[model samples]
Target chain A: MTQLAADIASTFTAEGAEPFTVDATLEAGDEETLVILGPSGSGKTLLLETVAGFHGHDGTVTVNGTDIADRAPERRDFGFVFQDYALFPHMTVRDNVRYGAQYCENPRDAEGLLAELGVAHLADRTPPTLSGGEKQRVALARALAVRPDVLLLDEPLAALDVPTRQSLRDDLVDVLADVTSIYVTHNRTTARAIADRIIVMAQGQVVQRGTPDAVFERPESPIVANFTGSNVIELASTPAVRSLLDGDTPGRGDAHGNGTAERVAIRPEAVRLDDDNGDLRATVRRVVREDATHRVTLAFDEVTVESFTDSPPEVGTDVVITLPRDRLHPC
Target chain B: MATETGSGLDVKTGRVQTAVLVAGFVGVQLLAFVAAYATGRPTWYAYFMIGSAAVTAYLLDGSSFVVATATLGSVLLIALGLPLFMFVARQTPSLVVEKAADPDVHRVLYLGIYGPLLAAILSLAFGVPLAHLLSEGFSGQPLVESLVDLPLVVPHSVAGILVLFGFGEGGAFPSISVLGSMVGMVLAMAFVAAPYAVNATREAFEAIDHRLEYASRIHGANRWETFRRVTGPLAVRGMITGGVLAWARAVSEFGAVAVVAYSVSFFYPFAGGEVTAQHAPVFVYNTYLQGGLQESGAVAFLLLAVSAMIFLIVRYLTDDNTIGGVP
Candidate 1:
């Protein structure tokens, strides 16, 4: 097990466009999975690639406290699983897994890894013939065979079908339990399932960092709340919502505001329908049925709050909902 | 636009319109053929003119624009192909058989084939790396890609002049006399044909996902090793297709090869002597200028048959569906 630390700053300049800069620092303990969560073009992949030594940057990356910023990708001993799997189309699954093992001093057994990843039956097939999930599994086996000091996965299951993605995501968690891994994805579900620690990135900066519960339940900024799928409500006109947000100061005031609390985020599960006396009155705008939960969108004049229930009320029905006192996170 | 009411009169009118259109198209082609013949052009020229007129008529037809345009486009391809068909049709089978047996014709044909083959091989060795770099967008990528297009746009005669000035005796490297030598012929052919190989290889390299190369690097392979294992094997089909196209272009080169090495004579110890530098096209032109149509047509027909056969073989070998593992 090896700890990894990186402080990276990168500038991307496209032709005829202003240059954009990305700056962030990350630290992961041995055997810890750190998930960098961000939308596309938020520099999550760029940060991961820079740490993998694919690009030069103003940064210091250390493995176990040894500077590795200037090292070549091969010398850095990092295994990268790409979004598209990037399996060699010319080689069979077995050979692709065997490829990286040849370069390792103490390589893992390629066949055993393939079997563990449940791709042993596809060993004789080339990448073009395999399904998306199979290709991803083979690519993971190939990367793991090298026994890298750090593993980097860039949206590893982003290209698969929904069912396949869910199954592979579960397998990924089991396989990477003991590996020092950095997984970057825009999907919060993936991050929540795999990350021991989550770094929320926005506009090329790390806006928030904490354990999954802290970040998801107590995001520090509006952008973090929005990205993490929390229901954000403005506190300007909704005094009733403001009163609901009473003691918990989890939300921060907007700098653009006149030195007062501006907005607050509450998880959808925290908003509960109350038949008895409730704190806030609202009109049900719409009801959406999901797998096991029905999401009810309630409108309070111009503000909207979403709440989930086992059975949703009819649309256009006047309802009273209560926001949990402890769960109103202001941002 | 006309509305269709599913009436008998509407159906009758549509049939009359179609008949009139077909008749007008035939009349235009007939007029063009008459004009070509009256101008004392070759029979094949008359056929080409009529083919062009028919294609133009289809292009100008107002009914079903998509179908008309597609038909006109395919017919225009036939218009370009008419001359080759005419040349093969005019040569008697007996004359082709006799020329095919002639050793002198075979020698010229072999020289034309082998020179281009050698040049294409050399170009592939050097062009693959250049194309890979350009596709990867190394610094100055735009400038380098634009420079590679020079041979494609330049006149074949200018390509010959440039080769002569660069590699000919007393130009730059005086010791290397490109005049009347195999090396000179190959160089001239390569100068004109290398761009095809480079462009095709570049396109192939571009088609590959860059993440594959990144994955290779992350797997502990160095830059060169990644290229050899991942990029090179993935792009091999495109490289080979480019090589074949370059070889065909080189074989057809007359202006450059002729200017550099007009006629190469080989003297053997047992036999008397042989001339090999007369490439197929050059040999046909010279025979036409010296002997007449009969001798030139025989050699032309033989060369055309052999070239077509080789082209088909190469195309079959490099077909995309058969190439390794690509879906």
Candidate 2:
């Protein structure tokens, strides 16, 4: 299996504006989906386009050890699905699929691919007449028809309803099962669902990169922890959370040798409610129902902690809660 | 049941009223024509025709404002068209047919048609690429725009002087005999009309999405291939429409062509002594000056007919809604 590697440094200069510089290195293994997660203006799309040979960069990009820095976009054989789908408005669905296939040395069956993408009925319809989801399906089918070496998707499901996004996300996993792909998105839920590995970007640089569980559970940086939505509590400010760093707590103290870390994060689900055997007692400030679970915001001295449980205690009720030592992550 | 019958009778009465109105209109037109003929004033006949057309249009449409505007426009057209039509009508059929078949007339007509067509083609070839660059935020686009607009804003005769100074003998290229040549006539016409082609093509290119071209490049097409397949087809309609307008303007141009090339005969060395290379409008003006109204009117009438035919054919081919059939 071949790997696609890129080490890029580029600058974007608009007239009468300050130049923005982007520097990052990325790698995607064969049959792996690597999701680039970032906020808007973080240069995620710029990085993808640069890797696809659509823009000039200072460093090198190679596939299977061959440098493709100077190659044209077509010669690079990278399939890009733009944010708006960018299907040729003048051509029918079948024609658009065939348009890409005609450029390939050994093309896939375009009609069969469209059928697999669940857009076979739309083969004769033009792009403007189709719904958003249908356009996305046709666009994906067209990109796949070329049998490209690397597939680049820029927010492929960003413009869709919740149900449609979920369905298509599932479909994408199945369709891209054997293809090397790089997906750029700002939505964390989408990143979690689509990525076998996640690269979190901030201000045009890669802040962190690891498996979704490792990054989400044990973020190495504050930006990563904040982006992953983990509950970050300052150990020096919150006495109740500070207790986890003490040697009295069983498994948590071993991970942090001297308890020198200032802040720690605990997953909301890891904060549990207990009656008799608990480390801390706090007053419930608010309770809200979320799907099948209850979210209780507990106020203890200067700190507020959120815990998920089967049934939430009423506001103003005093309860005993415990933060499992092993679940506490030092940041 | 009573209401339905009343409505049916109302519809029948409406039809009768329309029939009477149309009959009255025809009767009035006949009377006007007879009165103008009795007076022996063909101009009066033109006024009557224009007045009848306006009144009939108003009666059917029930809009006085529109009718008044239409009447004003029709009067202007009739003022120019009537004398030519009457002069053509007065000539013996054989004499008019003989004039049409004359080799001198054929030479002038050919130069008038083909020169402008060549100018339009040249404008498209150069203007399209410039328009594309300008649409992409070229820094000097405004300067180019203002330069193109110079010919349009200046008087046609001044435009002729400018072309002469730029291209004529004793000018920038002193050895070239551009004056009284076909090249001079083409240059003058193109200078006055190229703005239309540039502006229209620029707007068409701007209206296209840049992502369409980017997608084409990603689909394994080179830059030229992408333009040939995507950009060219999409912008062709606007280019054709602009070319037609430029050609029409060039064909009717007189002041500039007259100042630069009073006659195109310099380029036609083999033409007989009687033959001349006068543009259509220039030929008409010369005839009116030398041979009175009848001869000039016949030539003007022929030019108008040819211009009208070209306009209709181009308009039909470049109909907005049907171009490329995407919409």
Candidate 3:
């Protein structure tokens, strides 16, 4: 059953500025974590806020078969965590967690939730004094204290440093295991790690929705493929690269590679760099040092592909790049 | 090479800068003592003030930018403080005590302090609601704000005349005459002082993150409840600070009170009122007109001491328990 269903359409209006409208329809199953993945200004936050009833919208929102479209945010039963952890600075951590519990009939104990999120020792401190990771943990505990019908988070981990973000994300996986949640972020790694189902949005519209693997591995649009960190090559512009995907993943294109698909995508991990005997002869364009490996950009004719290698060739050097047929997915 | 790292200097440079700043602070105190305690040879001390400020600015940090900024700040501080400190420092304790004992001075001081206190209370009653409305925002916000801020730039005498035109017997309200009453004095003071209350409270409300309010709301706090428990508590300090500032502005006011109510009769016959005692600023003006600079200065010192004491006490009470923003 759908735990929360939202059909929201809101125009973000700023004085003396052009308005941007976010129109989206989505649902999360009971005990499932549905994630909204998008870059900045893609309306992911706007869509989430409108669904939470912070902004006036033109569509209906229901939770567990109850229509809450006309209800104010105060009357709604959704718990929202802002991107910057909007914990009241005047209140102690324990008070903040107990805040939501004041309105609920059967609320989880604030101290127990604090201990559950590993922030019990920080319960007496204010939000400004806590570290980034500690503040986020306290925010999570506060949101869950009310046992909300659906928890809506707007990139709660984005403000932390890299190490803090990674550590908190690991904790988030366990915390969000069974909570019906709607999380939003631009980080593909986090979405893949935390989401039971994911939707990709761009320019205020949902571009794709599916299980994480289905969306990342078989993106049906070039925008989705590019945003998910896959290199997209137009099959028509580089006709020679078509034959390389002879036995690739299922494509909308026919056997001759002349069909409805305008582009094909391949993950950088799948693109192989061979010194010789590769299917496509290419030249190394650039090599950037990444953690544990080097990302080498190879170009053959007009088609450029990125490949990860342990020992990368020098830039402007001749190299043979192999595109595995099974790895190229049509978009 | 001398690199400009904006306070992030190398170890040796950082240590030298710190030493120079500490020495400069001590030099400023020495200069203050010379100007205040030893008032003779004013010319020599004036030259020293200029020279020390320039040298200290250049020596505090290697960067010329600091040299310019520190010098500018020092000059401004000296300009504002010179007249005030000179007047206070020059007065003898016996004469100030003599001025306070005068019955005429006592009635005016009481009127001066209590009149502005009432005006501040009146401003808060009306100005806070307007500030809250302004903070929520609407179209033509700037226009409304301009009207709220009109009194700030209006000439004091014109503000006085405008108050007379609005509140006098034949003006807007003929039934209630405020030509020479305490109400008339309070109205004129609030006319000029209400803007400080409104703007300060508005800024405080705006400083609170909207998301915090939303968090309160989603946590089941209704509109009034959210404001009462969250928004109202956070903005209380700002409101009180504004009220104190409004009080200060009202207490120092002279032109408007002179036109609206030169001498209050509500507290008359209660005190030794031969012709009805006036507010402090008006009394000071009257003393200057009747007597000379010497008598006026003595009474001015009395008002100054009491005003400063009250302001500092209020400020200490409402100091910073600021609502922290998530950094």
**How many Å off is the CA of B158 in candidate 3?**
2.1
| lDDT per model vs. reference | 0.85, 0.82, 0.85
Tens-digit lDDT track for model 1 on A1-331? Answer: 7999999999987779778778999998998999999999889998998999888899799999999998999899988899989898889899999998778999999889989988798989989888999999999999999998999999998989999999999999997888999999999999999999999998899999999999999887889988898988888768787666565444355665334447778899898899968877899999999999899999995789898999789999999898876787667
Which residue window of length 10 is worst by lDDT in model 2 chain B? B266-275
Give the TM-score (vs. native) of candidate 3: 0.87
State the fraction of real interface contacts model 2 keeps: 0.52
TM-score for chain A in each prediction = 0.95, 0.92, 0.93
- Model 1 segments beyond 4 Å from truth? A15-18, A244-260, B1-63, B265-276
Complex DockQ, candidate 2: 0.39
Here the TM-score of candidate 3's chain B is 0.84
**Model 1 lDDT per residue over B1-327, tens place:** 235455667889989998998898667655654565457554655456545545565566635675556556756655675566556556778877888888777788878787789889978989998988888787777788777888889888788889998988668888887888877888888998999999999899999888888889989899999988988888888899889989999989989888887876543323456545587788999989997887799998877778889989878887777676244
Docking class of 2: acceptable
Top DockQ model: 1
DockQ of 3: 0.43
Between 2 and 3, whose TM-score is larger? Answer: 3
- Interface RMSD (C-alpha) of each candidate? 1.4, 1.9, 2.8
lDDT: worst 10-residue window of model 1 chain B = B266-275
Q: What lDDT does candidate 3 reach at residue B133?
A: 86
TM accuracy, model 1: 0.87
